[model samples]
Target: MRSPFDLSFRLKIPLWGSLLIVVTTLAISTSMMVQAYNDVRSDLVSSASSLGGTLAQTLFPAMLHDDVWQATEIIRASLHGGRESNVLRPELVFVLDREQKVFISSQPQTLPLLADIRQRGEEYRRLVDWIATDAGLETRSLELAKFHRIYVATPIVDTGAYLGTLVTVHSKEALLARFYSVAWRGLGIGLVVLAILLPINWFWGRRTAVPMVQLTNSIVDMAQGRASHLLPQNYTHRDELGRLFEAYELMVEFLQDRARLEQGMIRAERLAAIGRLSAGIAHEINNPLGGMLVALNNFRRRNGQDERALATVSMIERGLHQIHEIVNAMLVEAKGKARDFAPQDVEDIHQLLAAETRKCQVTLQIDSNIERPVPLRATLVRQILMNLTLNAIQASDRSGEVRCTIHIAGDQLLLHTENGGKTIPPEVVDHLFEPFVGNRESGHGLGLWIVYQIVTQQKGQISAESRGGVTQFTVNLPLGDPA
Candidate 1:
């Protein structure tokens, strides 16, 4: 078990991002819902006041003339459903005369005309008590919510005549229903916004977290001495994370290159030690062989008369000569015989590699810009060309192209081989010419090493590059006098 801090940013970031989005959405949605409900509630209150005032104006002449028919008509006309307006219509509206009796009401059955207003219900009695407490010539409101209605008392008068009061009872149920409608509508819109935004938020969060996770994994792999996966770089994003990713990539490259360089130096040092020992051994064997050959010649000159002895001596001399030749090869360059580099040598290599290319179903392109023989060691140069071309062919995909190009670059013979193949890591490429660096079953990894030795011995340069699905090897050997 480990702390939550050990959790990968890849997983953590998306989870946290989703949570943040939900919280923000809820906050915004609740605020909007509250605001919407208040707006509708304000409109409801305004409608109650407006309806009360309008009814009072209409009922003014009715109250003065005792026209109950006109008063009832006015109250009935004011009753409207939710669809008719943004605010709910008043549930119960009625007119009161100066005697505090119910003159007219929309609900005539429950509230009889010309009845004492206070004696009808306890709610009415409360309204009457309120009127007596504050006798004013203006529209007033009383929110009797516990009684499930609001009492708006609007005074009726014509030119300062104390006519009557127009009291409208608005039900709490209607007011609440309108508020619920506004709240639901606001909530529906908020849900729609959440539906659209949530997925996008999640996806964006995942997109951002993916790269960070990959980068973190890469660092872990590098620390554990494993091949790191390549990060999906977003150079277009110039954020902090993007910069960090870029920096990490550059750091990895630098470290790999440094490691390769160090490995190459170590390999070179080992090879130098081996070369020194080999040269010494060759010299030691050569000195004894020269003395033995001289002694054998003298013995042959003195015993020529004995036919059997002479025949046996000749056979021994021939064996010694073979040994001498082998030693000579080991001492200087490993070649049957030395020859100058020529254009025909390129054709010979092409002929050899063509058979291999055919077997792999790969295309081999050999281009030589040589018009005549070049002053270089034919054996080693051909070996370098053959090895590089073979490696290119092996690296290429089936039906892919392995291109070999040869030409004279200044005073040096240049050999270039290329193939469309898997990219070689910079670390592998750096010490590629060192012995046993990329040792595998297919090769002893001595091909490039031998090539490197020959080039360095000939005062030449050789390098390799792999990029953009293309891997290339280039060798340059200085033109020499007859070997």
Candidate 2:
């Protein structure tokens, strides 16, 4: 069984609203109907008593003269006088003597028996005795055997002597009919009001419920990783729902940004570990490379006369030279050589990245506009250029151009590298120089970090930007006197 509390918010609002309306309407209607019934009853009793008193007064002379026929005539005329009056009609009339004997009556056979009255116990007996006393005008109402009636009795006084009691009996049927009519009208009115309010309640509930439902679904989508780039912008109202949409949008953006930062942090950590490993490997390789170079040099010198041997030696030497350059580039801090940066040095760095450029099927362009060599750390400069060029080559589309421009601007050497590819996203650009912040899957995220560190150490600045499908990195290094 589904719990009652499991209802949707939309349904719950209308359900509870309707329930409240119905309950309140019923309470008010019941109260009003009961009050109307009481008012009618009171008025009926008052009218009966008034009529009974009038009859008693009219029959006083007849009673004083001991004319029973004249008293009976007065009672009969009064009972039949108002055929169209709104007053309660009498069903029975009784003229009781002081001894509780029925002297005259409209329906003599229907007169209540003392045995029957006493059978109802003390309350009924007291009521009957009080009316028989004929002290003054008194009234009593009773319902017995489906017959409801109000009895009014007034004492007939003749020369300060009690002649008899002039009693009138009024039926409650007409009063009951009026009571039912008013009750039904109240019920109908309450029903009409509830009918009117139910739709309005449903409509209002729907308005609130639709947005809530959408928000719930959106939250679920977010949890399941199916959320869109931004939250839906359909809500235009300046209510709480609109504010909630705004808050959700902000939350999504924040979470996405946080995820990117975490990924970058993880990549940076991985690269740091790789860099440590590479440095150790490079240090170990250096000793072996030195011994191989020496052995090859000796072979080349001894095999100078043999053309085939010399050719082979040259190839071996070239391979060793390339390997030595790579290991030295990897161990830049180990070399720690600072010297003037000449055009040839830039050419050498370009040569170092040539294999990578070809592997990526990208064309590399080099431009130098410096008048003379600039004083800089040769090893660090070579490392920076090699890393930047390799990154540009990898970032470029197949057969796209990677442009490298080096020039002297006032007291600074400006180096700019541009690659043709998709524009870098703003989030990546913001942390471009941070370790392990590359957008590429295969990137170690260390090249730019190393470049940034080297440039900052040399009192230079580096900045990256991407626009119109091209990404560029610019480095500004302070020029020093050539040594």
Candidate 3:
């Protein structure tokens, strides 16, 4: 399952943007609804208070003269007046004397239940008492039967003569209906706005998401070595993604240039190593050639079935064979192909380095315990051994022994070379296998570096250490299937 934290930019940006728009829209709509509700309630209370005050003023003259019929007609007219105006119509109107006695009512049938107002609750009693005390017009909300209503009470007075009280009850159903109407209109507008904004948000999101997705895909392709170039047309925008694409192009170009340079350096180093090896091989061959020339000259002097002549010819043949073997080995190493390592390859290296060791007056020792053919490139193995043996011989003191050992451990082949010589300095040992690093003035320093490259290329490791008046090099090659 994909992690929630791994959400792509395409989804994350659009999701959050939509959510923000929705939340803001909802908040605005809700606020409008609340304000509309309060406005409607306020209008209802104001209309009730205005209608009650008007009735109190209209009924004052009739109440002072005790004209119950006139006061009733005035109350009925005021109640019916609301029907023609955009004000909450009163459901009931009651005229009560200062003694809290009902004298006139718009609905005569409710006159008997006016006395039940005192038994209803403290809120109604307080409202009635407040009006009787001439505390100005007052409004209160109460549930009557199944409908909630607002009551507005006003005092009826004639020249400070406390005539009676005028009470008007307005049903809250109309107020609630108006509130709902405004709320639904607001909701409709919000929905329309949301519908229009959603598409725009989606398009905007796609504009950002598509480019980022393309850039991501391109990066993935580059990482997998499937894409070598990016098109400028795809990232033409003046944005961060465009900058990233340009950066990626520059990086790829740099990498390609660096790769080419490294390849050239490696080739140059290999040629340099080959040149050094050729010089050593030429020296080895020159010595044998000198000996062979002497033998040939002696054979010619003792010709015609002489035993010394036969031995001299045999000696010349052996020298020619040795030269041929060394040349063949050099040719093989130059080819640089993976091949099984035979015991003869090891012997060939010893013979190739014989002249160099002899010239240095170093005693070279070969200790071989390899019974099975090693699964490795013969050329690389020979090069590694040759370089180590040469280095050992060069490092050893006069008449000091240089030992080369080959053995198998587990499924790996180990080649080790040690020479009895002055311990190598710590500074030189630190970068011993690096290119152009060597102790000898005549050395170009590419020999051990080439050895290191070959060993690593064959999935092997090479290490060197110097201690106790001896410098040693060890190479471990895995005997596994070729990669």
Candidate 4:
């Protein structure tokens, strides 16, 4: 979470990287620049010395040998070649005798640099000491009027005998001015290159940081129950970041699946607890309810009643029978057995119940839209449909209508049913699908419980809704077509 401008070693990437590149580049550049300067200066001095030796060799000995015309011609030629050699060439050249008197000079239009070798005493004395005492040629700067020159001198010797000295002068201003221009130009180019690299460094740093940012955000979102989008796919890179992103995506998927499994586990635990409670309640009431049904049936059979008497007896018997039926339903749900799987036709089965619903003065609507060869366990599906429809009929007071609708969409088969019943309370909504927990005075809420188990074991979904004074339940099953 460090800001980009912090520029600390640990906080900023581009700053450190760019600083290192620049520092290293400048260090190398400075070393090379100094070396280059020394080299250029050395070459300049060497070239000047070579030109002076050539001029002196051609002129001095021959002049002493009384060849004045040849010496003069050689001096003119040396000066011309020196001028063409570099932009800043020698300004003056002169020879001095053993007494430091100018013996011969080039460009004599000016007064002798040492007017009287003895009268212009001190300056010449120091100059002589530097040239004679120094092991190599000597260079010193001089200013006369407005022009500046670098004075260079070398001992002139003939056959191991000391003759005098040879001197050459070069313009200081011009050499320095040109060097400054070139140096500045090189510095400007280096700075421009450094500037261009800045954006590139910024871009690379941000690209590297973005994935980490996204991963952090994803982790936060996943901590809540929200689904997160997958990270951007980047398979080309085989680095650790790519591996981390891949691992993170896998972990998220694993967590979501584990969460669903945990929810199912919790629901199962709730059902088990309810089943235990319902089984105890049903066991307590079942025998008495069964006895009541038996006595009512026995009395009716023995009496040989007329129609009015038989109808009253039949009503009482049927009412007692329903109590026994409810107790049995509770026991069945509490046992919680796993259902076997097979194929079944829902419409054909609905036809069997059509007669009973008609006799009860009730309407039955069955949808056969999913009659296409569906893979389902015949017994389980029949039990689930029958339990749910019967619950609907009973909730509707055995007189109100019960409607069943079935359809198949894509890879899922859906069955929805609604009956004329009161809207379920908010508090009861959560427990509606639980075993032994329904809304009948004699009811153990096992009907939906069994329905839930059958549909869920088939990898299907079931949900109930109560709205506008009517209750509806929808079951969804994945279309199992072979594999």
Winning model by TM-score = 2
Report every candidate's CA lDDT. 0.79, 0.75, 0.76, 0.67
TM accuracy, model 1: 0.56
> What does candidate 4's lDDT look like per residue over 118-139, in tens digits?
4545545565566656644333
Superposition TM-score, candidate 4 onto the true structure: 0.59
Write candidate 3's Cα lDDT for 188-243 as tens digits. 99999999998889788877887788778877887786556775587687677788
Cα distance off (Å), candidate 3, residue 194: 1.5
Candidate 2 residue runs with Cα over 4 Å from true position: 81-87, 108-137, 140-146, 155-164, 216-249, 303-315, 325-483
lDDT of 2 by residue, 112-209 (tens): 42224434465445556766554654444444424466666677765667777776766677777888889889989998998898888888877778
User: Model 1 segments beyond 4 Å from truth?
Assistant: 1-33, 51-88, 94-138, 155-166, 180-263, 280-330, 333-369, 372-406, 415-453, 461-475, 479-483
Top-scoring candidate (lDDT): 1
Q: List pairs with backbone clashes in candidate 3.
A: none
Mind giving the per-residue lDDT tens digits that candidate 1 earns over 1-483? 987667666666766776787788789878877787677666666777777787788888877888889888888888854465434577778888888988888898888888998887888888898987877777788877669777788888777887888877777776677778877887787778778877887788778878777777888888887644474544348899878877887888888888878875676676667556656887898899899889889997784368887888789889989878655544546566778888899889988888889888899998889888888878888888988888888888899999999989788888999999789888777667655575245765667767777777887877788999999888888898865
lDDT of 2: 0.75
- What order do candidates take by lDDT, descending? 1, 3, 2, 4
Clashes of 4: 5
Provide the clash count, candidate 1.
Answer: 0
C-alpha RMSD (angstroms) for model 2:
7.8
